[model samples]
Target: MGKPVACLAVAIMILFLYYVIDVISHASGNRYKEGDPIPLYANKVAPFHNPSETYPYFDLPFCSPAHVEEKKEALGVVLNGDLLVVAPLKLDFLVDREPESICRKRLTKEEVARFRKAVLKDYFFTMYYDELPIWGFLGKFDAEGIDDSIVTSVYLFKHIHFEILYNKDRIIDVIIQGDLQNALLDVTDNKEVEVDFSYSVKWIQTDIPYEKRLEKYSQSSSLLHNMEAHWFSIINSCVTVLLLTGFLATILMRVLKNDFVNFTHDEEAVDEQEVSGWKNIHGDVFRYPRCKSLLAAAIGTGTQLFTLSIFIFMLALVGVFYQYNRGSLITALVLIYAFTSGIAGYSSASFYHMLEGKNWARNLIFTGSLFSAPLFLTFFFLNTVALAYNSTAALPSGTVVVIFLIWTLLTTPVLVLGGIAGKNSRPEFQAPCRTTNHPRQIPQLPWYRTTLPQMAMAGFFPFSAIYVELYYIFASVWDHKIYNIYSILFIVFIILLIVTAFITVALTYFQLAAEDHEWWWRSFLCGGSTGLFIYGYCWYYYGATSDMSGFLQTTFFFGYMACICYGLFLMLGAVGFRAALIFVRHIYRSIKCE
Candidate 1:
């Protein structure tokens, strides 16, 4: 026991040190002097419409350095589909360069065909200098003419103009533009043609501080245009929450109080009248739910996900996961989720024990895999698709091994320790009323009062509260838009959870009042139904709002969205069950029973 404990401690310390060193290595304090070598890296190129399907920049017939070299990046960057390689162009800090030819190449039929196809699909290329990125279109297709006469033109940009902004020794911004007017090459035919790749660089002094350089990208014109709409959606959700809260408060205080008064009448009066409603089911309200192990595991996973979301939002709000850091958010997510596995184990073990479950080992194992198993299968399928397409989104062998080791060495041990502690300290299940030897018969109800309709009603309000926000989130993930509004997102997240809890509690009360004793699973499904609506909304957004269209992008989008919705379902369902449990215990404990 002592040796095992020591090993666990060593493993945790090692993981913590690894992340700390990684963060320190990414410190943004790069300083350069005049005439210093400024290396440029060419990243991936992809169709503007299908952002997920990206190939290496060198995949096209672009000019390359004699000895090709790739830039090492963080795990997050690689996962985000970035493949940065050293470009052939020469650049120097604070030095202006006149237009100069990079290389001359005679285009073959195959090369010309590839370029034309890229232009027709509207491909874009990304480059980076000193950790700052810039983008430009490869080429364009245009058709225009006077009335009734149309002339089609297909051309590629042969020249690039780079405008870099700097403040003293720090680089503020880097902008790249394709010189379409001056260096357009006609690519309408398969004839052999000589192409000259030329570029010009200009350095401009700017007063913007290095700390504030990322604001320009975060505050894009598109974001500004939608800012008012975003705020309006937030306001509308707030109103919905307020209305739900008021209705819940009235039901809890007024209707429940009257029920309590009638149940507390004199013994003679109580004998004369029939006792129905929730009071009649006091003996069965706390019956152990079906699939007890699964329920415990789901609640535990939900608790971990809820905690993870709060931590991420707080970190993003405080600028730890800043906009300039390309892969920081995803990196944080992976590390945090690994560390939070212990919470899942603890929650699951305690709940399982409370439910009188005897298979402790099986319960613990199920808790650990409740969320990750499906996620791993999904990623495995997607990774295979990405590899077949030769896309940079595929995870490398080393990254996969490292992640596996982290889960095995760190996450598993912590989870085991937590489960042991939870089992040892598990609280006894306490119900306000004693259970009878047999279950009571349940009365039939109307269609609206049934579980399905109740779930639909309970789910729609929560989904409506966040569908508007989902648009922005989808835009950020599928499109190339950067999302920096963490504070607003945090507010909406709180609203979503609150609305879910209130509606679930109200629905549970109604079900119980109608003499339904099986509120355990129904309460959870009521809240989890919101995930269905959220997934449906993803389908609508993909078809209507987004330009993304391709097999790879479609699979990646829906696959990941499904994972996200499942996590939300678990989190929301756990919240609903907890709320209903509290309401039941309070009302039962207050009853005037003999």
Candidate 2:
């Protein structure tokens, strides 16, 4: 039974590997690959004769200088080029009877009402560049709740359209913000419809000359020849080096050698040695030292990983990936990840106080170091390079100083109080009852010995963004299509949640196998390893895109993302693993004793 279960697990793992390899391999042939050209619209552009005329082919209006319709305000300012301010200060789309007339022929009255009905019912579809969607459905079905009043509301309504902001010089990610009233009819007098949406960034693809061959293999309908390939070179990836991993005897032997030993070895039931590695401050974590250290570590790592996962998904969902500029997002993600550390600190402090960690100063210092110290060199090197190149935002020195200040002044106190509250709280961890009949030390279940199943589960959450973004990016790159997948970042929220759950489950199983009943740290570590793959992929991307120069390439590649994601993922992995570990331990401890 043990052998067969192991075999099944091996088979499953192989299939998963194949799936990932296929994605990356075919990724180059993506629908909208960097260098690919955009396809021409079926109907070429003709000069618009009438100001209010409707075109025959496309639905939108012709490009116009200025013609305000009746629509309510939705978003912020719209910039013309890379510049920050170029505005009506607050400019958006003003909804009219039908969209602005670009084509010579006008839409039939029915079509005119249809446009208003669509807007009133479905609202608008937003597009952003680096976005993380945490809520709302992808705009698929027509929206609901449209009454005649909505369209007729005050005779004019408008929604602000702006690319969620992205400074090639500054690593920025915009979250999805959508809120518009549903149910509107009457399009006779363009009324002002109120909108309630939020901010972020947006994206667009330029068309390059089209080749018939491209159409044969492409999924994207739009193709232009004036394309730029980012990081997607064939020579740079270690992707081809992978071998069929059906687990040879030696492979199993190696795994067993390491894990089996760890499993069988008996550990001291109680932690006897001094709890000295990372000290909690003023007993900030809890009153006790060792327990506080463990909890703090757990919190810091878990929160960090969870947040990182959210961002990755958000970007992927939007089909926005620049291979030549891989590192740019990394750096920004790192800074964003700082927030996770703060949350972790707070969680740790709360758990520590519950466990009774004694030293307050130790809690703060150790928790801070658990995060800052480990990755300091990597971030420092990145920042130094960024400043040297005169590329991207240097995260104002004031920001760094401010961060530390916040940690000590604001974070520390919040954590301490939360810790105290935790001390007075009750355990919420609950585990499924152990129900093995005639329980065997060596069970023969296919999934019994390995944590692969759990790890696979974690993949789905992260993959959700990948699922949406991958299809779009693939279409745009390899196929040459256009999709509004990146409008909002919140779309990734649910996927992130799914991923966190998977990590927690897998970590629990790994800990159980290790028999390190003090399985918290390892649990977190196991789940946190996914971030390593992210960095690996980014590095691979950097070497792939050929058009970028060494300097522009480097700046574009690692400028915004590389530094940020690396730091962020590290912290993210730590937090995710910790969360899973602690949750498992809590549940494990509560199981009915034999």
Candidate 3:
């Protein structure tokens, strides 16, 4: 049985790797011959401020071909607010076309008003062909030759120039440049307004391979500035980690050594050492924390999230998600999270068992739902808002059902298996010192050493280390900016883990020195407080920097931010708790105890 099971697992892993590699290789459009027809897809349009709130391209009074068709998209694309539909225009591979009008429409009063509003709001259009994206603004703001004071005229772009770059038969890049000056229509309140929508196609052969094509899109006008900023942030975080490590190695280690010497001396002198400082409450230091079930569940879920983050970042670093498909990233996230549910189950169940917890079924359920339930509720609320606004972000019923099935089929059974294994294999709770019959009295400390102050201090350092990179990440998510600096991201992630672990261990040592026996949950909160700081930073960014406004943008931003903050809390909290646990055990074990 064991042999068969091991063989099956090995085969399954090989197949999974092959499938992933195949998907990445062909994520872009397939090869095509000369003169073969290439299909164009029109995605949604949205204002600059609220990128998530998207409406269909045909929402405006644009003329369509006789046989317009809707395209079926992947689940990730749909979730990303992309509603791809067949475009009315036709194009042939490697064929150049002269300027030709695809559709002409005489706008009525209402239609002209809508177009004017869209242009004024700075709306942009998105289209895709051969899996390459094209972007263009709907209109240009009027100004007289770089002088904002001189107001000329407001006009909409009526002609689009498409430049397609190809390597052999594969499309390398698609560029859309609107002829705003030459082909434009004046925006007036005239009752009869005629507009001609025209386009031209040009193909350029490039030596760049298909794999290197995405590098062009990954770059931005502020590439130099962003690179400098990223390096500076990385260096800053490295300095911070070095300082913390030095403190831990020199001061913290020296103090703990002294404490161990005094503890042993007193133990030898009195047979039972007169309790004081950390040694006074060694008995109760390892006592099970209150709300053990919740803590266990949180730790379990956090373990899974940590693993998921590392896997995704590594995959991204290897260029798996830069295939010009937004859905591919989201799809990978969902699938990875589902598959890693077993980690959460095992961690939670084993920890709960060590805490002497009962009601195994309840603990298992809580562990499974700890992270997912809140996320579901937030998505539900956001989906309702999207539906009311007629935005493509609203998930369809079928997509919802598919997600449910994935959770039910792929996640649950693995979680059950992990729980069973954890329950059977759990060892007895180990402590360096035995607990007394009665709990020791914790003396009052200075204002700064209190729980709230420690949390504030603990959270600030970690937040400071990552806040600079947070701006870039926020832009990528909320402003449609492409984030391709996975290497920097991975480095910053490692720095965060190092900083969190060392700081928590330092703070835990201080708490124990102050004779605080209730270090279990406090250590977790100390590390977890970074999430609170991050959430507060979100509010600051939204108000001070972000141009986003309106109910839809506000709710969506905060809702998703809340979920992210909560996850960070759990993951960091677990790191802190585990670090402190090891530290406390070492310090206590170093002394002589009855």
Candidate lDDT scores, in order, read 0.84, 0.37, 0.82
Model 1 lDDT on a 0 to 1 scale: 0.84
Clashes of each: 0, 147, 0
* 21 Cα displacement, candidate 3 (Å): 0.6
* lDDT minimum window of 10 residues, candidate 2: 74-83
Point to the candidate with the largest lDDT. 1
Q: Write the per-residue lDDT of candidate 3 for residues 130-236, one digit (tens) a residue.
A: 87787788886676656475546667888888889999989888888785467887774545698899989999999988777767777753443568767876797
Cα lDDT, model 3, residue 64: 71
Runs with alpha carbons beyond 4 Å of true place in candidate 3: 1-20, 27-29, 143-152, 180-182, 270-274
Error of 2 at 463 (Å): 6.4
Q: Which residue runs does candidate 1 get wrong by more than 4 Å?
A: 1-28, 144-151
RMSD of each: 3.1, 22.1, 2.8
Cα deviation of 519, candidate 1, in Å: 1.0
Better of 2 and 3 by TM-score: 3
